[model samples]
Target: MAAVEIAPTVNPVTKAKKPSFQIEWASSSSEVKEAQRLRYKVFAEEMGANLSQNAEGLDIDEFDAYCDHLLIRDQDTLKVVGTYRVLPPHKAQEIGRLYSDAEFDLSRLDHLRPKLVELGRSCVHQDYRSGAVIMALWSGLAQYMQKNGYEIMLGCASIPMADGGHFAASLYNSLNSDQMAPTEFHAFPRLPLPLDKLNGGLEVDAPPLIKGYLKLGAKICSSPAWDPDFNTADLLTMLRLSDINPRYAKHFLGL
Candidate 1:
């Protein structure tokens, strides 16, 4: 596939021009390595997770060889700002692992036969945590998903808090996904959330990103799971193509 090119645009209200960022599927081995370097920088160096090196300051595993790497680059400086890895269900099945499977039991969904895409290792550079960087990444993913015939997107939405389990329960209490939650999925057997705690009393002030997913019709799948690398508990979430609201499709996908 050809690399995606994005052009810079000016903000109507501020009358200021913002640098454009392009998102594309990594086209070469070197590009993939660069993407991995970015991931290592974010997941390991910045976030304090362990990493194995391949002599180029990149953290990579067998899973990366088979997955598609989506990279976002600033138009002017050509610096990579954000990235996300997409793994198809067939590849995941062959490897006997789904990114979220480490936390959630995915066996029950076997009968559904949906073409699933696992999105993970999502990150944005600290300096470019603006809306444009994120929008570019999603736009690129949408284009790739449209091309690949993917029907569902699933992943672990990791929270970066030391006491993430407690926060996750509180999150679920307010944005309940009980109807679509996986019956057999959970993080740990012990430390089960008290019934009273699970009661719908989530704080009115939850994280914006989590709330955005709920608004996009994503369903939380069971309890959150502990993510050692991220030092947090993460909730599994899924977005079926059909479940995505039309307004979002029009706004994001330009459909």
Candidate 2:
């Protein structure tokens, strides 16, 4: 009888591990590059932001070198999926001004600079839009500010103007008086969105991201600035640790 032909025993193929996420501060140039590349992907390619990107596909600027980058990575894949660059008061001073200063007159914020941090270039990988990534990023930000004794945060929250600015115009118009920052804290837009000329009556809601900020006690600091390069109407938003909504403060800061 011919010897029975037997196949070698096969080992089961293992599947990739997933669903693990971790927050970290970028500690090196290479790590910062990873965050910048993700920003390029989301801002330039996905959102059509006219960014002055390097050939390395990184959304870099003068501020990047002076900022601390908070990154959220899929631990299983070791991929940087979300990032927010933060410029602390000292760094913002070193950089001459916050990034938002180009579009808005931030003189009103000068008095708060000693305890302020400017957050910018916030973006997440398209695959990680389930709210978890952003929350994780915000958690990291809260911890960062707490650790450093920073009391205030400010940034430009961008609203899409794909409808030739109507949605942004309408959203600005729709905000009640209380939703705005106190007059003393308000920044003036250098190139304001033409709210008067645009249709400001569309039945619209604030974008989810802005809504999230508002929920966390972020106040819109001024009229929206028209960003030609990104085609966004940007609202300068400010958040003070003391101002965080009680419900969210408990969740985000245990206060």
Candidate 3:
């Protein structure tokens, strides 16, 4: 297969000349469709998001049209290895819904100032799950956030599991609930799980992504909520840009 060719585009914010690995802001209709295609491959086909035909193997919704899409293309293969969607707080509030709202309540956050940004649909092709790909995606996001003056980053971090088993014990262990709970915590009672059938115990450490967020001083809000689409309960996490650990700031943003 011929490598997918991506033309280099200047970063609107920095204006610094850098040869990104086909990093571009998706603007055209075809680019959006391609993003949907990649989403289908990862979310529906690979992750089993239980989406209907309307989802078309694509994990998209009404918000996609209004949000900005970040795509990372493999230079040699020209394939989209990683992708994420960023929704500005203004747009999110106008839309009155977030990707996690289906799983958790978000109305309580209406009072927070400085606005917010919701990060979602974060997925990388299975074959290209590496530090470099993730780092590139974050680098692009950091630049975009810095340019826009975003104050906080919020999103749900999924804990992977085959069945409906939840894996947020470590998060509960790490951050606990009282110190920093989500303003809109889940009020519903915990769903039952067959603890005996699960592999070993479920109380393992946090996943890399969750740990990464915590290391960045992100606080876990409330308990886990069941996400049928992904077949895993997710814990909502929030990271204030000012609170991010200095170590990651240097490593990820080159500060």
Best by lDDT: 2
Which lDDT tens digits does candidate 1 get at residues 179-249?
Answer: 35556533332223343544334464556555666677777775656566567557677777777778789
lDDT of candidate 3 at residue 35, scale 0 to 100: 76
Q: lDDT for every model? A: 0.72, 0.86, 0.68
What is the lDDT, from 0 to 100, of the residue 119 in candidate 1? 86
The TM-score of candidate 1 is 0.83
lDDT string for model 3 (1-255, tens) is: 112223355667966553436666787877777777888888788877786666345666798987888888887676777888888877877787676677666556645524678888888888878666776777677777887988877787777766446344433544555346555633321442233444434457776667667777787765666666677667767777777789888855567
Angstrom error of the Cα, residue 154, model 1: value is 0.9
Candidate 2 residue-wise lDDT, 77-98, digit = tens:
8899989999999988887888
Please, what is the TM-score per model? 0.83, 0.91, 0.78
Number of colliding residue pairs in model 2 = 0
Worst 10 residues of 2 by lDDT: 1-10
